[model samples]
Target: MKISRVTARGFMSFDRIDLELNEGVTVVTGPNAAGKSNLGRIIDVARLTVASHAGSQRGNRLDVYERAPRHGTRRFRLAVGIELDQPWEQELIATFVRAAYASSAVELPRPAHSPNVSAERRDMDARRRLAPESVAVLLRGFLVIHYDEGARPRWRASWHHSSTGDLYEAVEPVWIMNLRNGGPLMRVKQEPSAPALSLADAWRRVFPDDQIDARTPMPEQLDFMGILKRLEHPISLRTGAHQDNLPLLDSVRDLYMLLGWDMEDARRGQVDFVHVLDVVLQRACVLTDNRRLPLARTFPLEAVGGEADLEDGSQIPCELYRLKNGPLPLRQRYQRIQARFTELVGTGFDVQATPDPERPGNLLIDVTVPEGDHEYPIAFSGAGRQEALFLSTLLGGDPGRVIVLDEPGVHIEPTLQRRLIQAPDSTTQCLVITHSADLVPVTAPGDLARIVRLAPSHDGSQAHRIGHLDPKDQTRWLQTLGPRDVRALLFSAGAVLCEGSTEVSALGTWWEGSSNPPSGANISLIDVGGDKSFGRYIEFLKAFSIPWVAIADGPALRPASDLHQQMKKQGILTATEPDSAEPDFDAWKAFWAAHNVFSLANVFGNDGTAAGEFEAYLKRLNLELLSQVDKGRSKPRIGAAFASQHPMPKEIADLYALIRDRLQPARLQDAQGEQA
Candidate 1:
């Protein structure tokens, strides 16, 4: 099943956070410490062993009332909330303070007759806030796990701490295991196993030492227990000698099969195609391009044609031909497939074309296999081709797997990576973790997930959660971050976020001009015309956590001014106008008067009354005149004063001319150069 939402409170770097997940595929990413992996672990906690997962009592007793960590005050808490399709669940954490426990400074009244007393105290306004015991009690119900190798873990309770001692857990209590990046899966090497009771059990059965506690939550059977009981083996669908394999396929096939496709009820559409000598045969699905598809199969070559003898489970070589009454186009068509990619390899799949000679002249054609190398028992292929074949198999055999590729293109090459990213959706929900610029398409932004930047924290020691940024700002932030950081904060959306083109370009140029530019792909600039669009973009930014800012000018700006009330009304952007900014027309006049301009007419002109204006008067004049004057003309409008009352420079007019004609995201010759 899909994880729809996640939330964390009082945990490590995450003081409070909530992330949303969509149907099909939801990509989780952020900086190395923006807490993306922490978020992933939070979800993994939900998937731990039922009886094994436990909430820490230490997490409950953190000192309340302290805004930040202090000398004596501690804030220990672990609160998690998970949302399901229908029946959702939440966990509230609380700490406990013993009746006998007392601090010298602040005293609470106790029963006169009884020397000892116990009361459930929730202090919302205490110095540090909740009592150490108060938070502990709240943590009693949720299942949380943190993976530290030294801790002796148990199925019911993983902690050993005393209320009387000072070793209290922090506000964040998550199971943290430092796996070496991705671990040595390719090499046949394994680590030494731990020997505690549960560790022994985990080691004997090859399970993780840590797990989540189940009995603490809803009386339902624990999600992890069932998973451990069922998911006892690797996820493989090939014929196996064991009995448990049946359920593995059952779980994957049942929960994450392509949204609308059913593998069991296979249906193949028929096609009647004729090749046009003037036209080229192409495979265009709306996933990559938005063109209407033929009602039935457009070409026989495109369909997953009838079976073939897959020799020893290998990818059968069959070159697809365009029947345009000609030979092959460039072989680059096959380049669309990842070089190392081999679908249905070892899955008993194969492909080939059967030439026809009996039928009339052009009436006869060659066959193509859509389910390439997927027909079982007739082939033999090696694991070397497994990566590519796995993709083809997922696309064909299963309609499509919710391809949760954590950098599917990482181990692959550049061209293959591009092709893999561009692969037709084929009902596949692709949740890809990538930071490749090559994967980005010039015309289509569909493949791009929303951009999230992970930047440094105020405190140099531990990084803080900086916020989302606009495409322009994101580029700067990412380079400061690098590969590991950017990989974690990736996400996708359905709308276009055209932040201002000028601002985006300015930011890009400013960054490039630096001794060092930021890492990761260049930022994507969506062209939303003015601050009104910027306002909407900002709203999207806040809602989704992408960082962005819109810059609009004034004088012509009115209530229609983007920097004004509109954004504040939408609650999208904060109106942080400099105190120096005037509310109306007079502010600019005063500022311009301070300058050497002869008069208000020098800048404002007759259109000086233009409110809600975004362009400068002089720049606008140059642009208007340039539009009227052809490129070949000797002189431009120059504001109707060419060589007259204080004639203007031809450079300014020429620049405006280019601005009006060119479509570059941004163009500047450094006040001395020209557009290429």
Candidate 2:
């Protein structure tokens, strides 16, 4: 199962947010403090709720609400939707009241003395006494296995009082209901009571005939904490004598512990119980930026030489061994992981966790790469290679789990960063929190990858999933751009979409020296290539709701027919074309004024000299470097020269005035919005 959405109210930095997620890979990005990390932590909270249980106290994972909500509110609600490979949507909800402490004791029901008292009656009595919210921890799901090995597997639905209207079946046709008590087992013959009736109503519409039978066993109540501690054992078995002490129907591991596991010395086995048990819980794995391998344990070894002995006269194995004595398959798995890691880091680079040569019995990892026709340790290599090797170690394990990566690309290059997330064997569903544009794909229509952009909204972060980019816009952006360029465009408050590189260069140079550069006002300069690209990018910007203005050559020099058509279609332009060397500025200005835009005609005055674009205007100004333009002087050099010219041209000064005046108000509004 994978998370499809997360809805939170009063959770860190989110006043109220409903974040939708896509299957497989979803990249969540935004400006810092827009709650990208908070969203990832929310996932962490959900994973902890499902994976770990409170041992001696109530679960503290939901303690995110310890502080008041955003804007000094009380209480918090979190809902997570998990998809089970079908249209089926399973939801987990956690609600916290300010006064409730994690240490608050929840009493377990005492065993009935009289056999006349029905187990169902005792179970209901216990459930009614517990808080509805505390029971949500048990409402995740149940792994139902038939005691009879040959029976076909199925899930039955029933409803009882639950925080999120959850129902989990322990076995076919035998649903577990009313999880408020440690292990309430009662048949749902009539309508479910109170809070659960709402869930029952929804369930009936989908599966009307679904019913809970009494075939499932009823056990004496166990404290939520006690149940957690008891299941820490490698194998928990319910035998013929323990039918009355069943486990809570929250996780597969708990279910097996409730039933029976007679495996011989399972605790000593290489595979962990949690790994096997997590099959039903839909395990989630998290890879954070600070990920590190745990400290290795050493074992006593026979001394190869007198130098191998420690001061205490004891020798320990020097080999940095991982699963060396485990099953052959386990050893092979690590080898494959090493191979894959080598492939990702680059050819001729490999990591070896072997015995330390000089310090016998001490484990050491040698990062080797071919240098000067000989292998050398990568510790002598650059930091980038070392970082990549470290990250690769984490990926050498299992695939097909829910992987959450926090800024996985922070220390890597653009190419490797892309490859990090796009690993071929990444069957795992990944929720990546990142600010790197290289990691954010301008995904095509119907692609599995999604971009979830978080922007500040009223003291909280608003999440917008960019489902698709206009094919034309994407094509134009990709024509001559990389991730960094696209990221700058995505993050900028507003933009100046101009004709070509010359205009971009000129604007950039001028903006740099000018106190009020477009960047200062959170505006960016995007060269949309030529006339056709300009039109496409404009449409793209509009589609993405990005505020933008166009700076282009006059109609005489480069008539943007596509842009003209678009303007007409949007009812922004109504005037007919004028048959002249220059455009009819009066009519065009009136139409373009409402939309933040201008052309060369609006900025510069034409002196009947045939000089039209930037380079032509530069030559008209009598710049000497224009003579060696092809050989050495380039657009940037020309732009730098234009910016340094004393007594700026009247048209150039006018352009700056227009940009300053227009972007100031936009910057103010943007600032206000961010503060909100």
Candidate 3:
């Protein structure tokens, strides 16, 4: 399932906001505290809540609402829209209320006494809002994986609270839900059905937890459990083995949830159920971040399942060494990771995962850069390369998972980011939160990928869907401009787009000489090629909400082109007075007085050739009997020289006036307030 929209009410720093998502990948961008990262966290929390509901519930009461913003309204609501291939859509709404259990008996009225009481006392106006079960039904059929800041995966053992207290049971409730029937549990071909045996009997025969409560939901038995239940002979259990291995067994289940059934099905057809459980139980992995794989000791490469001693003589997790039918051994998995990392990063650096000497059970990923004769650690390389390796490692292995990338570092090049996120109709769904414009692309409308911009609102922050670039315009932009150059426009406060390099230099020089300059004014003076390219640039800037205006040659000189008429139709240009007999630059000035944009073409003489370009018009405006202008002169060079030596021309001066008077103040205010 793909996320279509996220509606949040009173969710951290947000009073109410709706973020509509596209299919394959949706990039979230905004200034700091505008709540960009918070959006990702909200989704994670929503999914986690649903996952929480699939298993045991101690009571009807749940206290997850503790994290709600302290000062906002006492309630919050989150609604997510999911779309399935059947052309069906599901809306999941989760609500939370502050101190929901703190009220008197009246607040906790029984469902029979007042079935509507739950709705009446709900106070729909509350800022926080929902029960855990309200979100569970929608989370099925899709897996959501959240990568913390720096794009690091959160280890299975670490998803509980932040403390490091061997708290594997904290995840047991969620894990049990993952194995329940009709829960869209992974690693199996189909959802399990309700078991013929009771929960107590199933636990007694299969996995017996000393603490399991038989009354909770167990929609169906897992495949393994079903197999064990039907066995002709009872499998021998090591004395106290169930209690001693519960934690490790839970960890193995975590990996199975993520890796799915590819490895399991291979072993399923060949082995006895007892041997299968033994191999599955042995599956233990030491998870770490992409940047820092634990380096403890060195071990010899072995693929046939005998444990190799590390330099410190500690045993690696048996899972790493164990090989099952049709599954690659840990050594091969390591080599594959190294090769994929190299391919995605496009670097020849050698990556080896050797056992670290001092760390015993942990392995160290040694990155070596090739030098003339010797090699150096990969850390010696730049940050961008290192970040790329991390991202490549994180994204390469999984194909059908939901990946949430939190600030994967803006240093990853735009092209790579595009490739990583733009896989065509792939089952994987990627959501990225970035402050960099380089990661944002000009896409087709309703394309599989999109860019969403969040702006600050009075209640909190509001999110708006950013539309896409027309395909033809996007192609022209990419072909004519480098990714970096095009992306830079998004960061600029405002821009003055001109026909050629000459106009850029001329306007830049004039701005420098005036009370405000381009550098200090936080504006970009861009050479958009020519008159033909002006509309594309304008549309590009408008799509990103970047303030911009264009200056080009006269509209009258190019009669066949109705760019002016198009601009008027688009409401960008206003009507000017009827033509007068004589050339009066001031008379036409009234037409653009209220507009942020103006053109010198409106003021120049009707003489055809001279009004075709800015330089000709400048020369005509300063017509003198002994003028020494050269016809083949470098336009930008002459324009800059003229700007430095003489008073600003009337048209250029008036244009700057409109920019300062109409545009700069608002842009300046926004620039001053922009953060992150």
Candidate 4:
């Protein structure tokens, strides 16, 4: 199953977040403490919660009240919009539903004219009618897990029948059922006094005219206890009931039991829907986090006869043993893992599981790096190599599983980080939580739509996806800013978009000496290559709600320059240029300054000099010092050295003060009030 959307309220860092996810690899990124990890936690919780209901050993470990957002609602709700694969859909209808019908406890109404038709044939007919087409109708829905302050957690699984091919637009609840902790199963009724609808009723509501077997049991008459009891011995039930009956119900009961739910609870109410939901979740989703690598690194080795065993038998480290001695599928999985590792690390990198030299028969995983001539134990490898190994094991093993990776790029180098982002195949859906600038570049051009940027807000944290922007705007953003610039702007609390490297270097040098440096305040000094692109960069920053200020050369801000036209086109400059084709320095400066664009000309020209650029302004301040710098050095490098020794220019100092004040308005306002 692939999740198309996630909605959460009063959960973790979110008071309310409705995030629509894209297929393939979606990178979730933002500033520190902006709830990037919390987004992953939410998805992981949903995965675990679904697993819990299906009877997986992985159950929800978090307390609901503790996870609720501060000063927010005590109750929390988390829901996922799921689209099932063909196989899972078939299992729900043909396997689970068909078995429900074949139970001896469920009595179906017989057709008046078809008295000779056997019950077995009628069950087969019912399943055949519900296959492919009905599967599509039933598979598009949501699985919700929610809790109230004074109540235990409850689960509601509902499906929508779509006539217009839009799942989100689907208004009718075709199948509505609820599962409560240690309580009886409840089918949601349209009215309080009315009887709750069953899956069969849902089908009839959607396809009213279609003829169905009268043998199909109603919700109230269906014997859930008898069905679950028979599920314990699926083989016997298959022979006595329908020949096509699969052991799906047995797996469901096992999952339910694994979740600590008693078999006797099946007697309380109908749980046939739980059987259907379990198969969808258990078989289709896998959530993983970066914490796996550390565990694998510290896993203790124990000698078990002639084989290697981890003391705790952790699945992650034990995967190495499985690679060496498990079944053929696992060995084949190892080959895929090795291939992926080599692809990301380099052509010469190789991973192998061989006998440990110290422990005669015990197997140990070893790696051969391109730089090293001899192989070394994996434990001795660098963290980057180890992370690559762990990630490779995850991505290469299964193509069908939906993989959720939390901060996988933390230890990998920039180049490998880019490769890792592109590693997942087209068929595998991956949700990656990352703050790495290295991973941002790979999503450009085609996959820009896959970026979901989160930021802290008044309520809690909010998510914004590039896909939500107009297609033309997304394309323009790609053309305007480089990945590094995009990363700087997206992750910073505030950004200074400078025209050239000199302004970036000089301001950065000056800011470093200040009591409140840019880094300390989470501010970014981004060189936008040239002032012509400043308007585009500003627009992109504004789109994502990132605060920004621009610094431009005096010439760039002149009425006759190309930047004036670009800024005008972007609506950043609304004033009409002077009738004469000459620089209106004062008028243009004030016009752009109102939009937070500072000009070097105004700063230096106050001394009545014709200084129109940053280099010229620096020259005016200390010509001898600027000349004494190494001629081989780049302009920015010399600029940095020059700014480090001299006092900051008054205009630049004021701009710096403005940025600091804007970032902390209340402090600035209080100081102003004291002066007043």
Candidate 5:
């Protein structure tokens, strides 16, 4: 099973959020408190809720009421859309229907055959013919949990199905199951009723004479436990009774057990909803739980020998021990983990779990550095190394799991951070909540849509999936953004996009020299290569709701310039050329400035002079400082030297102040208050 969508309302930092998830890696990124981590928390809470309902032993539970957003609705809802793989869906349908037939709750039309035919053959034939019909009864499935201020949290499992047409297009409600406070599973009524009715009465009303229609509307209220008791009967050993037996039902129960469901409960008609959800979450969702810390320095020997799946980094030492000493397949997995760690650190090392001599039944983890031929306890290694090792194990594991990592790049370096994302196999769907820009470049250009950026708003947090860009534009976007530029723009409160390196250098120098720099205010200065590329960056930043202002050279405002032509091509500009000989440069500059694109000529009131160009303006303002730089030095180098040696020109300083004020209003107000 794979998750296609996640929706949350009035939950924690989310007032309402509907996110479409891709099949492969989906990166969630934003500045602090933008609800990136809250997204992970949503999944974690769902996982825990499922676990509580499915198992007798309850784990630590998150109070849903406490998680409600302040000043928002007291009630909240979370839902996930699930899509089952064809093979698994077929197996589930075949087994479930077969079980229903065996229990005598449903009867199938008899197959035309001779009396000499074996009973097993008849049952198999019936299942083969009925599987397609049953598939249509569960066309689309989703799990939803709702919490009210004064009531117990409730879970509702609903499926959209249809009796006719293709199952894929089915939209009619087939069945709905509601479970509250671990009580009996009840069917949701199609119409309102005064009170609950017994399962026998509701079943009789819905399906008389033990006849069943898989596509029939669910009754107003029916208890699954009562139905299970009514269906229970002793199986006869005679050949006549043997013909009615459905062996596939046994396989269905086993499948549930394999997925960590309680077998006894399954036989009693209780589905382990948590284990069913795990078919999508894959037990890897725990990696995103902030409460689960990394692997401890040492663990008991018995703890390291268990067969339970690794739920978090704390179990890594145990998992490593099992992999090292287990069978061939496991040993191979261990080697892969070792290779991954080596790749991250650029050094070969061996991981081993040695028995602690002083502490009975305890094990200590140590790393062997091949170059020095010495062993060191893993606890003594740098925090980055420990985190990298933990992450490498997660990436190297079997594929097909949904691995939701929350800031896996926290201690990892940039180069290894790229490798960390790349290491997950294609089948392992990764939802990474991160602040690392290094991960952006490694993502396939076509899959840029997988990047979901969040920003704060009046309601709460909003998410924007940067959908696919044109092929040419995608290439240009990546080319213009280096690591620093990407980090600056992606994580900043506001950004300034300029036409060339000179503006960036000059503005950066001025920013650094100020008592309160733009950096201190979380404002980013980005050189978007040239004015022609500003449109693309502006669109990209807008998608993430990042505030931005652009600085363009004087020539860009001319109708015949490349930037103007590009904007026209992109359909951002559509005005016809003027009939007059002289183009209105001042009017064009003013027009663009209103849209947050400031031209040097208009901003500095030098529209008709050489100072219209930023480079020319810098030379005119501080010729002596510009001359101090080497003649062969780049324009950016000269701009930097000029800003460092002299006070910023009045026009540039005024523009900088305006940008700071716009991006950091609260800070500006505080500074003003201090002066008063």
Candidate 6:
């Protein structure tokens, strides 16, 4: 059961946030202090919380009061609304432990200095989207959230939680995963103990008949980590303590009893316990949890041998580290060994437990890393590698489970982080909360990929995503931006870059109809941030094959002063319509203003009107008109008489009209006829 949405109120950074999750892979991104990690932590808390007053109504017991919202006349109605595709809509809520008011959390340098405080804090809004069935399983059934507030500079984290909800059952055969406790490792008050498997309960009993695939090599059979997890069950037959090194046969027999395996079948050589185990394990596939925690792949060979290719398209060179192992053909091996193991086990191969011959070492048959080597063990790599390996072993065993990864890139290289995102898994869905741009989809001019941006808010944290982007302003912004930072986020604010923030802030102001005197218009606008390092960002967007746009100002030209030409040379801006002017250096200020629909004052001659002191200089450009109002500062009243005489407000209003006249393509509209 994947989580369709995550809501946080009175949680770290999140006052009230609603984020829609994607089914397969949802990448969460933002700059350093944008609260990416905190946002991830909220998800961790939502899925793992126990009944409490802290985060969700089901928040962790210890931090319950700490994360609960402040008591209000209305209780502040802290809740995260989710729409699960598989299970059905179920109200998932958690109570906040504490809450801080906007006025209290933010110290206004000058209370009256700023006249545009939004009713919604920067991070206290909602980002909505529909939930896919695939993602539902991952969130509710199997989840891996990896966050590292653990180590400074670099964090390593992995987390997941599961509770039987209607969402889990819709996806059959694939059972929900158990709670994953890899977090801050906080020790909280223990409540009632979870119930052990009841041997007497017939319904609880697994297959009465057991059969082990005896022909399978010991190494190959026991090679997969998933093979061991099934063994993590309670033994119902035997009452004695589990052995430290019990004989394989005896242990299987004992577990058989505990699980309520038929005793008659065991004596008759029809080992029902082994049969059940084989049925559960055979042909089933597991996926690596490469998000928060990666996996490891190793070969004992020390010498460097040249290339080796196995009937597949991939080429593998022999080395101590084969970063790419390529996919292993499981079917071929299974077919080859089925007969041999069948003969060896005789009648009841399910009886299990076969001793190895010749070599004293345990027979871990055909245990080899697949061509797709996603794991990195620490002994060879580092502590982070070890952590990744452990996490992979724990979370990668099931494709049906949901995985939540908080800062999954901790200790991971940027390129590898990208690869982790690239790994293939059809059934498993991934929710990755990461600070690494490398892991984000490599966005182009117009790509859409699930991305969520979170930031601290006046009251709490807020989120923004693709679906929430306003159409009117957003369309124009995309024309300028090329859709780079705009992501198909589960829940997030559109991506924010140093310069991009300026536009988003402007858009936010304009969209809310509060551009000081108010733009007196509604526009869809979003920002596609870029920096010296857009390569990584671009790679992320492209990798996910997402559509988006990235907008940034071009560098100023000094000699030629050809702003357009210079920007084109820098690859910052590409003009569909080439400028005849080679180069003319405009001050950064001038160019920025121009992009914002403001014409330099010198561009228009004054028709001779008393210029507001602030716009006095601007009169030189538009003597009779103000190209663009300086937001709240400039008085836009003179147009009353100008527009009265003309069909439209000549200089300024005409331009505004021209922009408004732009007709968008039909596909851009939402189902409701609004811009999507």
Summed backbone clashes in each candidate are 82, 3, 20, 2, 1, 143
Rank by lDDT (best first): 4, 5, 2, 3, 6, 1
lDDT of 2 by residue, 105-190 (tens): 11212234522323333233333322333333333433221111122211111122222333321122222432111222233332
> Residue by residue across 1-676, what tens digits does model 3's lDDT show?
4555666666666777766665566777654446676676565455444433322231122244334542434555565444322211111111111111111112233434323332123222111222332223222222222212222222111111111121222221221123212222122222345333322233234433222333435322323333232433322111111223223222223223332335444223211112211222112111121123332234433422453322111222222233112255444554554565566566555544656677566545455667778887656776666565555444443343345666765556766666555532365566777756556655544431376666543456666553455777456656543445555565455678787877787778888887777676667788877666666667666655566766766643232244445455556765554354643555544443444445665444346555556766666656541144334667677667666666776667777877765555434444444222
In candidate 2, stretches whose alpha carbon ends up further than 4 angstroms from where it belongs are 13-16, 48-53, 56-68, 84-283, 290-325, 347-380, 424-426, 442-449, 457-460, 465-484, 516-522, 556-560, 567-584, 600-632, 645-676
lDDT of each: 0.29, 0.47, 0.45, 0.60, 0.60, 0.33
- Per-residue CA lDDT of model 1 for 455-492, tens digit only, reads 22221112123354567655544442333222222331
> Tens digit of lDDT per residue, candidate 5, span 329-348?
88998898888888888765
Clashing pairs in 5: 189-220
Give the clashing residue pairs of candidate 2, or none. 318-361, 318-362, 459-676
Record all residue pairs in model 4 with backbone atoms less than 3 Å apart, i.e. clashing: 55-255, 55-256
**Between the candidate structures 2 and 6, which one is better when assessed by TM-score?**
2
| RMSD vs true structure, all candidates | 21.8, 12.9, 15.2, 8.0, 8.1, 23.8
lDDT of 4 by residue, 535-606 (tens): 777767766666677888887766546676776676766555444454457877777777677766654242
Off by over 4 Å in 1: 1-23, 29-33, 37-151, 154-404, 409-511, 516-527, 562-565, 572-676
**TM-score of every candidate relative to the true structure:** 0.35, 0.61, 0.55, 0.77, 0.76, 0.34
CA shift of 38, model 1, Å:
4.7
Error of 5 at 221 (Å): 30
Cα shift from native, residue 166, model 6 (Å): 11
